[model samples]
Every structure is written in structure tokens, then in C-alpha cells.
Target: MNSNRVRAVLVAVTAVASVLGAPDQATAEPAARGGTQWKCGFYPTPGDPQGTTARYFHCAYNHIMIRVHWSNGASHLGCIEPWENHPFWRDGGNVVVNAYFVPVTPRVLIAPSGRRVCAASQPTG
Candidate 1:
């Protein structure tokens, strides 16, 4: 897709996820065997030359889409490749950004507990 279109999609998905709120834990799909889990934290947005951090960050389990919510009542939908342990995509200024999937090595086995999505993101700066 064109850059503008892609950005619009991102913004729309993020907005929708934010408005809909967190997924039901009882309904959340079980984490796949050997799913890659990245350490949750505040990381730079895609294509950010200045390494601008988002309000919250976390990769989805397997290929399932996840909603990572922010403190300011915003959220974004993103997912990570279950097969890869390293960063998945690079910033082409549209689709993906620097270390967008797994900015660092996989550490935690599960996302932090919360009624909210990607709760209490730790700063990785």
C-alpha cells in the first residue's frame, strides 16, 4: 500500500483498538508453543530518526493481533512473528519500523497482568 494509505490504516487500527478496549482474557487465545515474547517497554515509533518512544509497547503472541494501550487512553494493534526471536521489520516509513516486533531479546514468558492492554510499559531508553 502507499505510505499515506498505510499510515491511515495504522492510525485507524490504533484508534479502533483504543476505543474497543482490551481483549477478554478468557477469550484470548492460548499462547502457542514456543511463542516469542519481547520485553514490554516504551520504544521508538517506526521510522523515528530521533527514537521517539510510544506510550506503551508489547508484541502479540504468535501471529494474533494484540492491542497495546497507552496511558493517555490510546492504543495500537500490532503482532509479532512467532518463529523469530529477533527484530522482525525495518522502517520503510510506512509498514514497519525499527525493531518494531521485538526491539530486544525475548525475556518474559507472558505480558504483565492487567485489565488494560500491555500494562505498565517500562522505559527502555
Candidate 2:
């Protein structure tokens, strides 16, 4: 409980923190925009009169798999193969492979580095 002991403890903590190289999010630079962005598209299903049943999002990265969180409350840790367009879907949406049908597109997306993208180009229907 002495002044010297308190000083020594504070110094040790500072040293450990410096050695660990803790990052400060407030001062951290935002992640650069890159290929992790999703490209959404619609495809027709076989024997369907409407011809616009399939809906999906494709994302690709050159080096590593990127984890993304969709605005529709879906979090995915996929997109593995490098430079390949991996398909992802929104939560509670329907696909042609099944019986039920519910199509919805996410308007916002978040990446691992705290980078976010608002998909204004996506259809609002």
C-alpha cells in the first residue's frame, strides 16, 4: 500500500501493455474498401412462371475468407476459396431449392474490420 509499491505496479502494467501492442480503435484507420463487398443478383427458377425466384449474394476476396454480417440479422463466417465468388443468403429468405418462397435483400453489411457498406443500389422492394 506504499507509494513506491504503487509506482512499481503501474510501471509494470505499462510495460506489459506496450509489449502487447494494444490497438486503440478510436485512432485506428478504417478498413479500405475492397472485393469483400457483396454483389446481389436474381435468377429464374426452372418451370416457374414468374421467372425470378432465385436470389443470392456473391462475394469474393483475393487472399482470405472474409466474415460478413448481413443487415437481415444473419452472420456468416464463410467465403473461403480465394478469388472465387462464394454465395451467401439472407436470413429468413427463401430459395428455389425449397418449397416456401421469401425473398429479401439486405440493405447494410458489416465486415470484420468495422467497415460497413450501405447497399443503396439494391432494390428496395
Candidate 3:
């Protein structure tokens, strides 16, 4: 998609995320083979990038929490890293991403770690 379209999509995703900000533990999905599936805010959006440290997207549930840090670069798919919590791996300009609550099911497996998405995100217009 083009930059403008990507921006619009990102905005829409974040907008939809308003209602998904904090999911209830009662809504946690059933665990499968120990681990369950997780999702993003609909569309990927950039988190905070400044100061001495970098902020990331994260949530807490089932006594487990995950954090998705914004990548300086872009990839095709979201990510298949050691952990899949990243929700914002898109390339946007000055995006102020809001926070959301995270929940977990159960698991004892390791995922890949590195660049999240394989689809490179161009600068949003």
C-alpha cells in the first residue's frame, strides 16, 4: 500500500483499539498446548521513541505480560520473534500511540527473535 493509505489504515487501527485498550481477564482465550494466540490493536502503530530508554506496547494478564517495541526499520509480516507482542512495526511520522492492556493464556515454548514484520512499512503520509 501507499504511504497515505498506510497512514489511514494505521489511524483506523489505533481508533478501533480505543475499545480494545484494556481487555478483561474474563475474556482471556483458552490455552492451547500451553500457549494461546495474541493480537494487536488491529493496525500497527508506533510507540514512544525518546529519552534514555524506548517505550513499547505491552499488556498484563494471566500473570504474564508482553512488550512490543517500535522498530526503527520495517518488515513484511508483524513478527515471529522469540515473543509475539509487538503491535507497532509500521513506518509512520510522529505517531502518538496509546497504551493497551495485555493478557495471556499459558505456555512453555520459545518463538523466534529479531525483526518482527517482514513487510517493510514505508513512511506514512
Candidate 4:
């Protein structure tokens, strides 16, 4: 019985490790135009009473499209249509930016541009 238990535990540990260590699989090549993709989670703003952070996945090429999935059963679909018009892009020219969600806030900030940053803290009523 002890040997069986040990073997079961080893199998479980190996399965967990494999799942955590596996790399994301994407059909499109990373270098292909409009094919770059990143998956990241946003954290809640600091000092917020409610500890809720929005999670998002972003895909970009000519523009940025973010799918924000909130913990409160709500979601937001946003896009930086004029990403090139942003001052940060002025220097970089047409560029795709990656953004991570801030904790307790519903804001997304440009990872490179560092401009037009907005924070949406959990609503207090």
C-alpha cells in the first residue's frame, strides 16, 4: 500500500509540473505580421479595499485589441485604434505595444509608450 501511494504521488507531481512548465502553443508564428500574441494577467491597484484584478489577453499588429476579463462576471473589449497617433508611437512609428492590467484597477498602460495611462479602481458604493 505504501508503494502504491508513493507511486501515485509521483505521478501527480509529474503531471502538475508538466502542465506548469509547458509553453503556450500558437498556430501563428511569432515573427509573422499580425501574429504576435501575449497572455498576461492584471493586478488590482494598490491600497484598494477590494482585491480584484482584471485579467486580459492582447493581440496586435497594426493596432492593439485587448480582451479584459474581470472577476465580477463582466468583460471589456477595447482597442487602441489610433495607436500610431499616440505620442509614444511618434518616435517608434507603427509599433505594437504590450500592456498588463494593474491590480484593483481597470486601466491598461502601454508597456513602451508610458503614456495615456489610466487606472480604474474597484468601485466603492
Computed on alpha carbons, the lDDT of every model, listed in order, comes to 0.36, 0.33, 0.31, 0.30
lDDT of 4 by residue, 35-97 (tens): 422232333333334332222333322334344332333333333222221111111222223
Q: How do the candidates rank by TM-score, highest first? A: 1, 3, 2, 4
> For model 3, what is the C-alpha lDDT against the true structure?
0.31
Worst 10 residues of 2 by lDDT: 77-86
Candidate 1 lDDT tens digits, 54-122: 323333443333444343333344443233222222334322222333344322223334333321222
Q: Global lDDT for candidate 4?
A: 0.30
Better of 2 and 4 by lDDT: 2
Q: In terms of TM-score, how similar is model 3 to the real structure?
A: 0.23
The clash tally of candidate 1 reads 0
Candidate 1 stretches with Cα past 4 Å from truth are: 22-125
Residue 97 displacement in candidate 3 (angstroms): 22
For residue 90, give model 3's deviation from the true position in Å. Answer: 12
- Give the per-residue Cα lDDT of candidate 3 at 16: 44
lDDT of 3 by residue, 1-125 (tens): 34345445644553443334433222343342145334443333233242212233223232223322234322121211122244443344433233333343222221132212212222211
The prediction achieving the highest TM-score against the true structure is 1
Error of 1 at 13 (Å): 1.4
Give lDDT for model 2: 0.33
lDDT of candidate 4 at residue 57, scale 0 to 100: 37
Clashes of 4: 7
Query: Residue-wise lDDT of candidate 2 within 1-125, one digit each (tens)?
Result: 33243235434643453345434222322233254332333233444343444333333322222333334333332222222222323224533332111244334334345533322222322
